[model samples]
Target: MLAYRHLFHAGNFADVFKHALLTRLLIALGKKDKPFFYLDTHAGIGRYDLNHEWAQKLAEHRDGIARLWERTDIPGPLEPYMACVRAENAGGRLRWYPGSPRIARAFLRPGDRAELTELNRDDANALGKLFDGDRQVHVHLMDGYQALKAFLPPKERRGLVLIDSSFDRAREFARLTDALATAHRRWASGVYALWYPLMDGTAMHAFERGVVATGIRRILKLELSVLPEGWNESLRGCGLLLVNPPYGLEDEARKMLPWLWRTLSEERTGGTEVRWVVPE
Candidate 1:
């Protein structure tokens, strides 16, 4: 959706969570000599300009990454995530933010392929133009979910799929559930990450319970943000459901969350929880 250009939100709290996890997972995927597929559904412009109107208004990063960036004294768990953000900034003045494609590009090694998809025409065109001369990445204008289904079990047999939808459609949650179920059925052993806002606690709980009921094992949840005290309040956090997360992520979350809670949250204090939804 053009309404959500990502330029305005880049390096904000949500991006901090999503990109940090993404960078870490891709890093883990690089461990093996075998090649892997990195799929980004709902990829936005490959990169963003903080000077843009949207970004300049709130400059939300001032409260998010801006707080963490200045400090070299990061906790161990967040070291990898912090490093990812820093490298993307190139120790520069954090004027730009790297989207999924740019973040994926940063870690791509020889033989590793990245497939980025954006349904929005404007964004798709921008994505294409963003890396017009690059050969390692493929920008697809296709529906990301369908494209993901078609590209399952990539030739390399190891892959990661990132589904970060805008959830503009009422049926988006259902569609996401069905799509993830289908993708999981297609590549049971692959790593899958799904992001969703904290729209409604009851609704989200029901959704998660249903997914776990499907018998997908090792479903780990990484949640950040504190619940508002009043019964009625805007959803303040986002979550990542990792279907086949790499080893050490749970441990990493354990150590990383406290520092993030202290730094990124606007409440001065917040909540961060990482645990298995389904027992190992």
Candidate 2:
């Protein structure tokens, strides 16, 4: 998994779906006066240049952010997310893409703090340089799952943890579920967002059952598929599981995901889904 680099897939449809929801979570955390902490496990380079060779290889952004770059009818709930993307591309050219760390840092208040961990030394070094002089953001070169055990129950006692793993290893789904259970026990009140690709039905169901077995409540599951059933050429969809989601996010997702599916789906074949995997 160490060789897995996100640059090849930066700004893809999955990125769009994940980051759009991420911005909403960060916004909700900021509504209260108290400062909160943010932990990004598997943080890639803080930002990406779409023109880079690695990014240009797949040119995934063409079907992702590029589709929304000039659109005027973007839904209101997505404005904050689009603004973050726009900020990375000045002069009206969509050449840059902000990764989760950059997007999260944008929402961090003066008093808020963030900790980003990346196992890849090169990626962690790049991430560290991205926030070199910033006192509020810290970068760590460590395994993301281990980071949960190290940084859980953050001092602020209020924040969000984004576990956006690469899913490059075997048994990653089980690993995510176990890590979630552990982290929840340590910080039950903290908001946790776990992202995963839509694999075969059996694996997906097993993952859902695993999470349910954890007995964690209030978990929201949002998924978007741009390819129709039976289309398996590549990753057709991805899902985000939100633990302790902020109020109204379920409704916001109901509104936001369908619009995304409409705009991003291929031949209008696939669709969106927003539902609670576990209720309070």
Candidate 3:
């Protein structure tokens, strides 16, 4: 299960969908003066080199971040996320891409704190080195699901928890639902963002029902699929379920996701979705 390496898929459309929304959540947290905590479950290396052999094999970024790297019509809400990406590729070349940990770190105020967990030893080491001597960020070499139990109800009590599981194992959707319920029971008020790929209709519907069955309110579901329906060659889409999402996030997604779909989707067959899976 520890074999899931995000480097190969870094900056893909899924990352674009997840991280763009992630920045909004972080920005919403920063709007308050109180310091917040950020816990990244399944945190990979803080940054990725797209030119690496692993990444070059797929060259997925060409279809993802590369599409937006030099766009003249970048949406207003996406500026912060793009700013973080631009900061990493300061040489004006699209050589590097920031993962969720690095993206989250960019928005962390001096008073805020972040805890990142990675099960892969090598990735953990790299992640550790990425934030070495940074007093505000903490990296742990542990299973992300376990980190949820260990770090819930953070001392700050006001923050975001990102559950970006790799879904390499079977029954992962079930595990995510159960974990979200348990975490919500422990920290009902905390913001939670869970990311997942767009699988077949049967699995997707089942996952939706499982989450709704949890009875957690204020759940916002956002999805983007660049490929048309019935095209199952590869991962053509992804979604994020936000529990207790920050105010206006739904509205922001309503505006932002469509633009993303339009810009990223070449076929424009599959589109975007922004709705409440469970209301407050």
Candidate 4:
């Protein structure tokens, strides 16, 4: 059934990797002023209060973002990522944590439009209010995976789509892998970012193979493991699979991964890799 609350782990390691990519993507889409569109599938509760009982219970952020909070001059490639976190965590301490939807909304401007979809009714309603007064952003209470099929090649014809889900339900992968084939077919030039876990690196390979089989021509995969290769013998790592990723992002990941691995290493074999099956 795949039912999990993001509040428990808002700014954990996953957010670090996912948002790092998203920050770079928004920067790319922001390069031009053609009114690019931003779409977020699987939007969670726009804002998160780490102090909340749910969030405080785990306090994973203490180890994740907190570990990298200070330390200025972060890496060249990681600057944007750090910038976004700092912007979100402004106001002295980390009181509120913005999820994908909230972070996407921050980039929206007068002409820019943001479309967010959340399958969970409670989350959808909350997501809507997150941007209630903002006419530039629209929130839909529906399945993000389904939205992939409905909203593509947005009106502007130039934009970024973020597919970020907890994958609480394994079916999400099935739907996401299929939707990529369909969405890319409709808007092959559109930029799409797919966030995934690395518990089982092998399974992720299969998913990427399926995506490559679609022959999208341009796809990049970035994987990061908190534990070393032999650290957790029974556990798998985590990674993000990107479609139509911006130019030079793979190299960016290449540098940022090592820094992250060093800071969050749980095993001796833990490391990072940035590679693409298609030409950039």
* TM-score for each candidate, following the candidate numbering: 0.92, 0.99, 0.98, 0.91
Clashes of each: 0, 0, 0, 8
What is the per-residue lDDT of model 4 for residues 240-275, given as tens digits with 9 covering 90 to 100? 777777776767777788888776665545667787
**TM-score computed on alpha carbons, candidate 2:** 0.99
Please tell me which model should have the higher TM-score, number 3 or number 4.
3
Best by lDDT: 2
Worst 10 residues of 3 by lDDT: 1-10
Q: lDDT per prediction?
A: 0.80, 0.95, 0.93, 0.78
lDDT of 1 by residue, 159-217 (tens): 79999987767777778888888888888888999998776667777878777777788
Off by over 4 Å in 4: 229-236, 267-269
lDDT of 2 at 12: 94
Model 2 residue 156 lDDT score: 96
Q: Where is model 3 more than 4 Å wrong at Cα?
A: none
lDDT of 2 by residue, 17-113 (tens): 9999999999999999999999999899989999999999999988898888899999999999999999988788999999999999999999999
Q: Write the per-residue lDDT of candidate 3 for residues 178-253, one digit (tens) a residue.
A: 9999999999999999999899899999999999999899998999999977779988899999999998898999
Residue 77's C-alpha lDDT in candidate 2?
A: 96
